[model samples]
Target chain A: MTKDDLLIIDALQYVNWNRELFEQAREGGVDAIHVTIAYWENFAEVEANIAQWDRHFEECGDLVMPVRQAEDIDAARAAGKTGIILGFQNCSPVEDDLHNVERLHAMGVRIMQLSYNNQSLLATGCYEDDDAGITRFGREAIKEMNRVGMLIDMSHSAEKSTLQAIEYSQRPIAITHANPSSFHEALRNKSDTVLRALAESGGMLGVSLYPFHLRGGSDCKREDFCQMVYDAANLMGVERVGIGSDLCQNWGYETLEWMRSGKWTFRPDYGEGSAANADWPRQPDWFRDSRDFMNIAEGLRETGFSDEEVRKVMGLNWLEFFRDAFAPASSVGA
Target chain B: MTKDDLLIIDALQYVNWNRELFEQAREGGVDAIHVTIAYWENFAEVEANIAQWDRHFEECGDLVMPVRQAEDIDAARAAGKTGIILGFQNCSPVEDDLHNVERLHAMGVRIMQLSYNNQSLLATGCYEDDDAGITRFGREAIKEMNRVGMLIDMSHSAEKSTLQAIEYSQRPIAITHANPSSFHEALRNKSDTVLRALAESGGMLGVSLYPFHLRGGSDCKREDFCQMVYDAANLMGVERVGIGSDLCQNWGYETLEWMRSGKWTFRPDYGEGSAANADWPRQPDWFRDSRDFMNIAEGLRETGFSDEEVRKVMGLNWLEFFRDAFAPASSVGA
Candidate 1:
């Protein structure tokens, strides 16, 4: 399929949303995007974020539409709009209440990460000193999320928690956005063990384009990234791989601080033990914005991917994963 | 020192308080008691709990007084009242903010556990599948708690986290309510490694009296309990030993459910993995209430402890520990 004919879905992105950005996504032929709705927000704060997204849908109706089901992506594609799938980067939106899992799910949060870059009530994050696989509460939360169709995203979770979540969740889970650490040893990147377990469980991994996760950060070439994808596909079957493109577009330094520190500390916590990464690292020239997603498709094709493989990695795989992932456990026959 | 001459301090207890309970403690000759003020409560909820304690202090003025400093324990002794030392069984009251460590310390919360029975932002609890020692936030929290004179309590923390807290804190930490796991394989009990590390770091281990943490549960005899203490004293120096009791007086099964489940899960979570322990296990007949503390001292004497050693085990060691642990890190001189 030609690049234009391919259904492109940037599985995860937290851009400073506006009409310009939505138009930029459309300019890139992106059919759908999973937009992060919360990092450390509590239930009420998450509701505020959803309200903001509601306004975005109202005002940018021509460019974007809310996505609550797999069919919504098709609708967005037919309407030439970018479908917005609401996701949370932390379980804080549920606060201490497990029932809030279904409550948030009813409010259109289809994906919820068990933790961010720190330990949470649900599971250990990648930045914790040790990895506590999953808590008693996490087990119950996973079952509730699975029952209600809230996809478990473990992109920033520790290795053991990630693997356990994969095994424990009756339905397949997703990493949502992260690269393989074997390519570039970023703390946020997944290990080979985690990747294998993820693929074995029929899960999807949206390979990230975040500079810090890249082999050479911003200086990383498109060919290197595509090669990493090729390597990941070899490790985890091509069917379980997709372009998550953890693209953080148009956010400022303050936004990065908020992402890293949240309300957990009064001082700035530069996660991953790097004092040099205080500022947002530069994005690669090949994938600087939502509009640059096509470059990844081209790079994948150049890296020995067939047209079918390129189409699958670019978006089709995530589309299929989402179709199964977004349904309630009973209906999905998990 | 004779038993009557020694200042008796019960290091931990969560009782459904009333004037009668305060009178019972006074009758037990308890000079001070570290009362659990919060467990899984948020900041506002913790404040409400403090308000309730304030009412208890008002109504039971003849029997109890609030103890904010080590001197207050002596003051309670002089005044013939049981000094109430406020503590938290979980760090949930701090709720992801390091500043809350000092805030709650200023509010008379002298001792705070890094976690309850699950993973928290600060540390991993014993019930988790694995232990992720301390998080980056936990390190900073330890410093703040030390600076502010809030004793770091790791009674329910996982092994790695407990050891890390013992090593990381500028001041010695405390396992405020647990016994040696060698004596009883209960999940809440401490291991030899943890016990040795805690003693090597000049920390205190307040051996628990809760039946579940006892080897024989409710059937434990005074001789067996005293023998366990003697063994622990040999394992860890007698200077670092004391009584935390972990007494849960007058609470019903619903309170037990609240403790294990909290608000984190919709379904029941019988922590430490036994569904048969849904209700509070029966307290040992010899030490069923605060008034029974004299039995422990008598049992220790029977186990071949001298007057001084028995006095130290009963309360004097905890009194000295409180003198140092309740002081600011600078004042304690580490």
Candidate 2:
């Protein structure tokens, strides 16, 4: 497929929202983008975030449209606008009640990770000292999410918990943003064991282009990054891999602090980087912001991938995943 | 040691709290008993349960004393009273907050299962269609529980979750009440994999006397029960096995319903037994009430166990477990 005909879905991104960013995504020919709405906010705070997104949808109507279902991507594409899918990086918004899961699903929150950098109520985060896997509440929550057609994301979750979720969830889950530990030993990156399990279970791994998760950090070459994707595709089938450029743009140091040290702890936790450098890490020159997504596709083509394989990795895989994942449990196979 | 000299600790029992039950436990020469305080009640509701327990401790002071540490067992023995160790059969008492773990531990609650017969926030119950293992909240809760000296229990959790708990917990956990599935294939009975894992992790498996978990329900003979223990001892060393009894006395059919269907489910869930038999399952003639505990010791002695082994199966093993499991994390070894 040509770039215009191809479905281009960025499975995850948490960039500071503005008309500029939406225009950039539209300029990049991004058909659908899953946007992070909550990091560590509680129920009410998350509701406020949703309310804010509602305004953004209105203000940027010409540039972006809200995506509540897989078909919405096509709707956005037909309108010549980028589709925005809201997601949460942690389970905090659900609080202590499993009922909140269905409530959030109703409000257009399609994807929610079990945990962020630290442990949450659902599954262990990658930053925990020990990963106890999923909790009793987590099992119930997973069933509820699956039943309600909400996608379970485990990008920041620990290995055992990620594996258990892949096994336990009836529908396939997603690692919406993270690279493989084999390529880069970042704490947030996944292990080969988890990636293999995720692939075998028909789950998707959105290979992250976040600077901190890239080998050689912000200086990583486009060829090297594409080679990583090629290696991941060889390990996990090409259909199970996609792009989730976790590009955090136009956010200040305060946002970085908030992301790492949510109210869970009073002490500053400079996750993925040391405290010596306080600002957000530099973005790689090869992949910066939504506009650089096509660079990855071009790089993949150069790295021995066929045009079809490049298309799948660039966005088609995530579009297929969204088609299957964004439906009610009863309607998924049907 | 003689049966009289052995510290006869029943690792688990949930009886209708009355002076008669306390007297029966005392009559059985039980030194310490881990009593179920909460099943599915939330934090505030569990506090009400604890308040009720406070009254029980006040009224039954001569017959029972609250046990917060291993030293309390000896105190109860000296005073000729059974030490009551408050425990929860589910993690509901902690709700969604990790701080509640320390709060509950301070209130003298020691043993808390990650789930009941259904999924909880912490781990998957055996009744769940799929076991998601432990959740992110469960990981933080386990560490907090470990720090505060509360014991993790997994009697009603699924095999994967139970084994995960065994692997993840810093301190040894307990299967406070459940028999081996090898003895009887009840849904609640554990698999050999879990039993071996429990034993290898220096944990305790309190063999259940609940008829549903027995080989032939209420019709199971004393010799058969003893033989199952002997077989279990061969699989998991004798040091890891002890009596839990799971004795339920003077409870009506409604109580069974409450146990099976906690507040989490609106519909009645007839756990372990059918809805046709709503009342508590009939206990074997050899083991009916707290007073029937010694009968298990006699049965073990008859089934090729030496007197020392019988004492270990009856109570000594639990005493040793409590000795190591009830101290603050820092003081336990150092």
lDDT of 2 at B104: 91
- The fnat of each candidate, in order, is 0.83, 0.05
- After superposition, the stretches of candidate 1 with alpha carbons farther than 4 Å from their true spots are A1-4, A265-267, B1-4, B272-277
Measured over all alpha carbons after superposition, the RMSD of each candidate to the real structure, in angstroms, is 2.4, 6.5
Return the TM-score for candidate 1, rounded to 2 decimals. Answer: 0.94
Best by lDDT: 1
Tell me each candidate's TM-score. Answer: 0.94, 0.70
Q: Provide the lowest-lDDT 10-residue window in model 1 chain B.
A: B270-279
Share of native C-alpha contacts between chains A and B (below 8 angstroms) recovered by candidate 2: 0.05
- What are the per-model numbers of colliding residue pairs? 1, 17
Chain B TM-score, all predictions listed: 0.97, 0.97
How high is the lDDT of residue A333 in model 1?
A: 80
lDDT value, residue B56 of candidate 1 = 91
Q: Write the per-residue lDDT of candidate 1 for residues A1-334, one digit (tens) a residue.
A: 4547799988899998999999999999999999998998888889999999999999999999999999999999999999999999999888777889989999999998999978888888888767768888899999999898989999999888899899999999999899998999988998999999999999999999888888988899999999999999999999999988888878888888889988777777787536765887778888889888778888988999999999999899999999989998888786
Worst 10 residues of 1 chain A by lDDT: A268-277
